[model samples]
Target: MAGRWTLARGVIHERASALDWAMDSRPRSDSRARECAGLGDGLSPAELSNLTPRAQIAEEWERVRLPESDRKLRVLIVGGAGVAGRNTAASLSKFCPQLQLVIGARNKDKGVQTVSTLGGNSEFVHVDINDFTSLQAAMADSDLVVHAAGPYEYADTKVLEAAIESKTTYVDISDHEGYSRRAKSYMNKAIAAGVPAITNAGANPGVSNLMAATLIHDAQTENRGQPQKLRYNYFTSGSGGTGPGVLSTTFYLLADEAVTYHQGEEKKLKPYSDKRSVSFGEGIGERDVFLLNVPEVASARRVFGVPTIDARFGTAPFFWNWTLLAVMKLLPVEILKDRRIVQFLSKFAYPFIRAVDVISGEKAAIRVDLECSDGYNTSAIFSHQRLAEAAGTATAAFVLAVLEGSTKPGVWYPEEPEGIAVEAREKLLRRAAEGAMEFQITKSFCRRKEKQGMKLGWIN
Candidate 1:
């Protein structure tokens, strides 16, 4: 399974020039991979000059190698068999090859498959989150832990507690508000144990929160007045082209009520009930988004003091939306709430999900809109051609930041300064947006449905 270490779109990466990201999506060859892999520790000016922009960037990352003395930085990726965890492992392998990676998954065969693709310095370990001894032992050996085992509605702080007990730095892709609140309750314990932990570190909850933070941070820094309204709009094409975890998350979320904030008041509405048409900039255009119970909504209100906030998500091709709505309408609340049933259903539907993914493609868009009281408005839009890839980059960025000592010991949300320092924000954004087709932080409204010229069969 060893192959070229590539982002989804194949080459252009973090902080790449606009032209570089705009390059063709076709991937480099195996010969090219071998050439790059065999490169020496440092390249001469003449050799560097001969390489393409893509190679140069890859070389630059490779050059940031861990010393022999510092090579023991083991990262334990719990739930490594899941879509998000696997992608995060891929990103980590691509960007930082020096450290050891331990895939802590209950599925031995699946984890082994993930590890094989990660090249060297990677191995798999069996870990059941429900088994405290198994989870604790895995964390005890690793310096850092990434908890991507989700459908956080069914998740508890037991994993976080284990990480705290092991005194390991931790982060998770938990998108559920209840789980986030539960994880927050362990802040004191995490701090006391010297375990710097962050929750809600996925694509939307991860990168989207950082985007909102940037918009509000820039606004207030320039005296644009307090943010009055904040809206998070997200779109992902068919099944998000990932594993069962994502599909299961969608199914499990049907049980919860969507939470929105209005002028400091909290409101709970039916999930996937409220729909709004939002533009995701150029490539994605306008998508009909629905209200969902996302963690960032509560985090925005609690961390940023934004008076009003709401988070909405949309997916395509449009029929899937109807299918979810129908399920919510027909299924019993008790059934939706029971995770065992949901897990079974999610797996059962996963094949069809993958089929839709083939037709719809896996692109996704994220838009964070902020309106300030002083008549100021701004947004940050990030659109990637693949959801899992973007999620991986986002998760890996946070992991790198924590490893680099950017966070203090405690459980914190993405928007919080403790979880991500204001200074390191730009680097994280660039890293996360590595393969994105569109990544912009604009003062102007970029959410309007901007049209592109259609290419009719015979039209020039």
Candidate 2:
């Protein structure tokens, strides 16, 4: 989710617009299948067929793993002062000790302080997200560029454009629909420019997108004989250990409006006003949820054609979530348009919310449910803290692998099985195997009857 606390009213409208753009811009599954069938223009059928043996691509992807090697890599952490940026940068520095990390931001003091606090082998430089010149200068000679600083509103497309121009492999912890769409809008440009850029590399857009893609692909295969209906629910309990909590909090600030893709058309509604409850996991129990159009729902619907798609949010204190929503609805949507409001919210409200996250540990979880064939259902529950770290770590690892020529180049989202998804999934499984993150995958027998059928017991 987008995480600025101040833009709590009208930001939803902008966020929805961005999400719509990404969903609308997505290439259909059939078209993608055809494109993959070709493997691009250059290779002859024989060469393309032999680019890598089926076993090789699979075995290598699984065995080689991520967080690559000990080689000295110059990495640029854009928005390194922000939560995701610092958390990712710190992890990178720890795992890849040789990485020459640099924090690029408009605020040099903050950047310096971030690197200092992270205590990594890193430095800082000033760079503006909307300024092409500054971005170009900041990205110079960087092996990888992680765009962390964003509200990604109508204004921040240039940072991404500049990344393409700089020919630097890029990744972002962005939940902004527009950011993902704008990034995808340049698919040809990125390919033409010979640069690899992965969008929505954060939680929802990152892991959630990948999870939805994987589940849909499997269901379409397993239930090939029947028409499948996909219903998606992505819920988070709180922001993780990362400071600033910029990623998820920003989405709340923008939650005044509800935007969802219904029957191939975009629909809008008021937020907070539509209160609902959803079961997260077995032991964690059920909690209150509210509508927030996550990028995954629209992307999944477009890619999977799921009739009912929903992305919901739940918090620790149910009333707090409701109150926040009420405030968003009661306030003048445009009154916050004033820069001072954004600044004020950013400075004060943002800190207060972050404090809550810290006090509460921001412990979170996500449940993805898929219904298919003869009313059969399957699902998986993922942890927010683990997912957030994996989003940053695995994304960085895969980007590095792509740069190092370990994976084939192509336009890909986090969920698409081209560059990162496969490798990231493997790493994620290994993490689960190590008991670092307890993730459960289940398959259940479900039956749907005529008018009134048997209903499965859900957590709520």
Candidate 3:
């Protein structure tokens, strides 16, 4: 149950020609060939043509040789005063001690407090993520910037813009679909500056995306059938101790329209609709999950070429779930979309939410299920006792990869081959899974028994 299983049934296409281009430095003349060749295998011509010049360059840069840097890596965590940011700083300090850590916050006192708590080659810097001048000044001294400022629903790409301008590598735990799309739009500028950037690099979007990628990558390497459908199910108990920003984020998501792909077409559905039950296997069992606007839906559909992709999330202290559904049902869209109103409502509900958190305890889990044409089903599950720790650990893993040169120059999603190479995928997964209570990949088969009135049978 702790290890991985493989089943071979379908033809594994040759590893995309992109593997070859990774080493070749000379530029190809034929724009068409370059475009086609730049697209890793399995992508259609239309997908290739949609690539901007910078995105294409970023794809090519994946394999290009990068010069070694003797200077120690410097990482600046933008919202280091907050839970996720502080945890990220701590993880990096403990795991990758060679890298210098800087905690960026608007409040010097909180930054100092965090640095004191983390203690070790860590320092504090004053930075207001919304202020370009402050952000640029902070980025000037850092080699990489980790954006942990929350409630990304209303966040602008100013920090990312500053990163591109400063030519510093960037990573963010943004969960907002619109913000992720906007960050991706900066690919051209990032590539032109020779700076690599990764968006949606946190727990759900980050680890969830990687889970799907791991399954797809393994199937591709082992000759498993093509994945036809991908489903994401997540459960977090009582806000997982992440605080008001997380609550605000949840409220914002409840108001936004959910996006999913069905039969190879994009479909929009009301948030909190399409409820389903998913078994998390062992310690965490079945929970009622509902549709949410998680960024992984879009990333998986585009990168994995899966026709059906969807994501659902549920929280414990079941009444919290009920309350969310009730709010979504009773409130108008205009009021829900208002950030000020949502923040005010979130503040009002904080005490009640915290009371539930006290009893429910902080635990989080993500389950990703992939199905293929040959009746094979594969799953990857990651669970941790605390959401903050899990998210921070995963984000730190990406930071390590970026600092170690695993990532290339350009903006990329966590599941993108260019963002995380197939060769480095296993290593990244291992690093991210550290401290996880359960990390597993399971394989099984289900076949339709036509003779017995359409009965179903399972084969192990």
Candidate 4:
């Protein structure tokens, strides 16, 4: 039997959100039909017939797999024992087995454990992110540095500054607007040191930035239209099966007001407000996403030359989003900003988050919606069954790009043409799409304007 999936935007019924399904099983009884818990929550069927049409990518899984580098570069990954770090390290070893992996962690046991699992040449080094000398020491003799230690909400640029001073190529998974902005400000120093750095290079900020860049580039070069409004909508199930560590990051972001560009001017928007119901292709369906403080919003404004660009993010079991709103209204910003407090909150919420992850099953997707000046809209969508693997693959793509000497000497965002050439964008995305079940980029994905006052807002 076929899988049945239904999505209703802005509504929260976590139990039903996974949807009803049609299945045939060996133990089927004539009186009752079996209900199935869906796997590949984002891409079980991969393509949806009802979705808006686009020229989608079609590549075999290994087609985009990058060649192993013979340079034998050694990469020092700070916080490598953590979830994000481990994922990135796993991908690096998988794609570029020739490169030596240095897993830098404050915890020796965890780092050593992670190193033991990788197939390539790898080792673990002890380093404290807060201690400048320790951080510098870890990357002292390495060819590059990957600052996977994150939450990045209140994180100082100790690692980035150390990277510049040490002249090591740098990449990080930071998604915070403020932290990445400060890192970007170190452009001249990185260039002076003849170092290449890519900040905000995770899944949404990383792969999503490259996706937005590709969309805008194709629009201008191919005479599509003057690219106007760029809206980034991202969806992740439960904690994205990425563990509860991400909770602190999101909770900490509530302290700062989100910023978006408007008509070439900066506009301040309330975090988790400005709700937009977006359809993330097939199985993931439509979700109500709200404005969030993502670095790409501000950085992409400069890189893509767009005045009206903003980012929205929505996560599963819908009440989780509502819970954030509750936290904002009930707690003061100062309390949310406190690292210890947020860490405690994250730890407290882990069991609940873990429960949701079990049902939600780690599915995730990114939809980059671009509204051109021509009034027609073209968009790109990427979906993955596993968020950890996808995030790792995206970050690993950026790491490999920097390793191959593709990025120039400067602290750059993934979307910057100078940092990652438009020509190189496809390859980056190709590698980023490594384990993704479904990914699409089309200059011609269009939607017709619905007659207003008929069935207004998000009905389209």
Candidate 5:
């Protein structure tokens, strides 16, 4: 596939350069080899030594030409300084070469540095998420906007408003559980405004949605009519260059102790209500997990009709979880929000939290275990802290592909179609490989004991 792409590129290059060769009109078989070599023979000693194999190849063949697929993409990535933004930019540059990638940041210098380091044809713009005028100005003449800069706990929907106003597609990696739930309120307006918006494109929210969709699809096909049972034992044990780090989420978990959920009916859960033993691949052995109330699972419940679903997450090392539990029990209710307390945690607890698994050197490793009806049980583990960036990059690739007519414009997610998901994953993996940050996904399933069937239906 890569060789074919290279051959096609060569042909395009040749066609584009044909006009120059025609003007010269000095093409004879004798000059053919020399011209194809591209390196002028009269090079000085310094130039001759610097010549590379790739350069020599460029000199030989006339590149093939095809009608350019107008990926008329002017993608504006908000919060381009962070890890996700940087990864997204890198991926877009590689997979969507014809895209006009723009990275926007409140800090001009940071934006410039991000674009310069990430490479590809990229530009930098100074914009603030909080400031509407700034967002509007930066987003002008853009077809898509990916909002990656947020603790969205503090962000407003002004960015979404701007996107709707500009008639541009919008996607965000929002960690704030509140924002994601409320985002549905604007779906009608967004649809009416003729713009598609995604509230969470990062892990948990992004990948979780796909995982649920895939499971639901499988369940529907396998099961006939019974209650489907599903549970997720998810864990990520590494810090990456982007998105909310382990330490930050730890603070969030500590602060939000009272977790609410739906049973047969809606109810509240004491944080850690359902603790269970879980396991990942080698080096990442068995670990205890706890159910935390997150909007991703909630959205999955509402969006996909997987009647019984539970999501449990925890970092490994039995001692660590025990200590965290102890801290949560002892910490005073009021002190959870204390500035000094958070600062102290940032200074002291975060470093230790991030270093829990230095042996593996993984940015993160996530495992999702599913036990469906009819005794089909499976578990898949993915390791890569760079996945947050891959999510952003994959999103960018999709946006570019949509603009290029490789895909259609509509509200969509990774699991909407297997082909689309595979393409996006390929693009992301290619870019990740270039950066030495590969996103590895492995799946294993077992049909242990055959049992009763289950019924499945789309909730929304």
Candidate 6:
């Protein structure tokens, strides 16, 4: 019987036919039966039927191919003086020597220092994100821009607007929900300018989003039904040795209500109210995770079509989480929402937070679980010894993909197919997974519970 196969969510869907029926009727464990699930070769049924199991066809899919061009690519990193930005510059310099690198910073000394540290075809440009003219001028000479200078909670779209105006590709590690949504609103303008822009391209939102996509893909490929739920759990040991910007970001996140999508509709939950125990697999084991306003929830829900999606995060030296809970309970909504007050509070707590960082060291992990029909569940876990390095690596992987012409001219989240094509996904994953102490995708049969509630947080 004549039939066609289509690829969606990284799975092949075959049109029903007599051959399909025959293939389904056979036991999945049988080698010949397994071959039937594979993409069949472009041959007549008679020819296909005579082929051996080892000779079964692999489907040829269309790739998002880019035009052949030999122009030298240049990447300008906004906030290149910061820790994450410096790490991204270093990674790009080490991994992508073909590209010219520019560091955009408001501080000339810091920018020069970062450039000196990165060496080789790297230079510094004095440009402030708040100054659109300066940003646009800095971006004018570059092919792409990576925005790493952000708390992003109260950020405007100045840098993004500048990039669009300059017709330069853009990427940012923004984790704030509001800023991410705002950045996403520039999709049309980005496409019109023929520039690809990606937001939430950091570790949790970036790698976590990709993990969810991969799990869904794996489940569908195994004939598991559509995913019904997706849960993201993340953990970091004491601010991951990053500077005060992360602390400010976390404080702002704690102040906001968590947004989750349930039954294909949006729902708001009280921050730090509903908590769950999630296992980050070996090494990291189990930890308590609480609801947070992360960007991945909405992005994953829309991209994967999952009915229920939520993201939760926890920190090591567990009292930090309790402190956030306490702040959420004690602080007024207006106070929590005030950026100035939040910044002041974060600064006040910085000394203690930094001390915790000294004690906890920098370790981070992310777990993404997907539940589908027939009790089929799959998860992907990634852990690194240091959060800053992991974030840098993940961001660098995305930059490389853009430089390699993987993304289309549109604003997208990392998990979206248009943001990173299937051909580039594997390469990006490989690069990001480097130096991860634990990185694996597994079928979870039973939910493991090492601890139950907030009361247990004291022990770890």
Estimate every model's Cα lDDT from 0 to 1: 0.79, 0.56, 0.78, 0.76, 0.54, 0.76
User: Lowest summed-lDDT stretch of 10 residues in model 3?
Assistant: 1-10
**TM-score order of candidates, top first:** 1, 3, 4, 6, 2, 5
Segments in model 1 whose C-alpha atoms lie over 4 Å from true places = 1-69, 445-460
**Order of candidates by lDDT, top first?**
1, 3, 6, 4, 2, 5
List model 3 lDDT by residue over 149-248, tens digit each: 9889889999999999999999999999889999999888998999999999888889889889987876666666778999999999987878788888
Worst 10 residues of 5 by lDDT: 1-10
- Please say which candidate is ahead in lDDT: 3 or 5: 3
How well does candidate 2 score on lDDT at residue 294?
Answer: 59
lDDT of 5 at 198: 66
How does each model score on TM-score?
0.83, 0.73, 0.83, 0.82, 0.70, 0.81
In model 5, what is the error at residue 349, expressed in angstroms? 4.1
RMSD of each: 8.6, 13.2, 12.4, 9.1, 14.2, 10.2
lDDT of 4 by residue, 154-199 (tens): 7899999999998888998998878888898999898899989998
Give the number of the best model, judged by lDDT. 1
Displacement of the residue 332 alpha carbon in candidate 6, Å: 1.3
Candidate 2 error regions (>4 Å): 1-71, 117-121, 224-256, 263-265, 336-340, 384-391, 394-411, 419-424, 428-437, 447-460
**lDDT of each residue in 377-457, candidate 1, tens digit only:** 666778888999889988998898888888999999988999999987877876786666677654532123433332111
Error of 5 at 112 (Å): 1.9
Q: Judged by TM-score relative to the true structure, which candidate is superior, 2 or 4?
A: 4
RMSD of 4: 9.1
Clashing pairs in 6: none
